[model samples]
Target: MAISTVEATGARVAVVTGGSGGIGSRTAVRLAEDGLAVVVGYTANRDAADAVVTEITANGGAAVAVRVDVADEQAVAAVFDTAEDRFGGVDVVVHAAARMRLSPLADLDLAVLDDMHRTNIRGTFVVARQAARRLRDGGAVITFSSSVVGLAFPEYGAYSASKGAVEALTLILARELRGRNITVNAVAPGPTATELFLQGKDAGTIARLADQPPLRRLGTPADVAEVVAFLAGPGHWINGQVVRANGGIV
Candidate 1:
């Protein structure tokens, strides 16, 4: 079910891509708590996405789960359509949908590289395009990048390259949308203790990376979500920049 725009007339609306994932889900909830109706967009995990929506609605917030493939223009368009149709107009778009594959560039399978780029690079562009077209005045577009793009960790060639493209486009889009009152930015997180980051990582590897940060711990999904919340809400002056939400690992 959709949240009628009339019921949420003054409330801002948000569309969070990959809302089933750790950071994405937290962002959806955070935005709801900040008084925005949200559209939780997921690729295949409808159950997970629905759970996010249920959590928000159970708390008396308005939210709906939308199924979308970020790389598919039509699917991404539908996500924006849902947000506008349900909650009036979209004011914030968090393009947190991405894929990460680790392999030395020389050893990486061409197909693996292709898959990562398709989702991380092309997918971001598809989402950005729609947000630019549909977002109401003073809206925000937040894309996901990786701190690894700067750290240059081994076996992160494909993933970092894709995020590099995201950062590159973020600045360009911000300029393209000049005078439109929309802020475009990218959030790059480092050493987060999320299911996605923990996968296939041994405890030793995790601990070592965690300690590298000045805070001496891995960043939590909530940590990154707060940054997203800022950009989506009050951080109006922060535009066309990449905010590193990595606990000062850089």
Candidate 2:
């Protein structure tokens, strides 16, 4: 069934999954800067999520940290419930929770693939389903993908495949919400300087990727956060698309 946009009553609110660290954390803070109450969702890092909440509160913004396993439907529902309970309503949902495992197609173990699928693909479905059900009219659902889907980097097959599914879900959900005043989009960041990207790479490998982008520098969390803030705010006209936050690597 198509849900129409509802008139928002008070201050806007957002639920950012995986909001404990990296790009998610920065995006949560950025959304708070945009004057929206934020729900910081985390899977295991309670302290990191708490730090994000503290950062927002210290800045005079409102936020809460909720423990949620994105792959679990019931757990995700509770996260949203916390949002609506803490704030007035859910105006935005940022599905930034994903699991990345890099391995060549032949070398990838089935267990690792399953884990990635559970967290990345299933998690996206769970989060987007909840967002579609609960987000108010004029809401924005921003999902995360990776530029590797296009870059076709070696050993990124599994992670890229999962993110490709995310892209598909983003587009389909946008159409499903026909008359709803909400936007569903995915942000595919390139080789950003996030710990996830930097974990196993040496300096040389990092520099090589940084140079692939015309900008000649790795993206910062803040860089991607600006794009998210735009989609959450004035970029309403851009819908059902994958907005790559890459530095022209394509």
Model 2 scores a C-alpha lDDT of 0.89
**RMSD to the hidden true structure, all candidates:** 1.8, 4.9
Q: Encode model 1's per-residue lDDT on 26-67: one tens digit a residue.
A: 999999999999999998888888888888888878888888
TM-score of 2: 0.95
TM-score of each: 0.96, 0.95
TM-score of model 1 (CA atoms): 0.96
Candidate 1 residue 169 C-alpha distance from true site, Å: 0.5
The model with the greatest TM-score is 1
User: Lowest-scoring 10 consecutive residues by lDDT in candidate 2?
Assistant: 1-10
Q: For candidate 1, which ten residues in a row score worst on lDDT?
A: 1-10
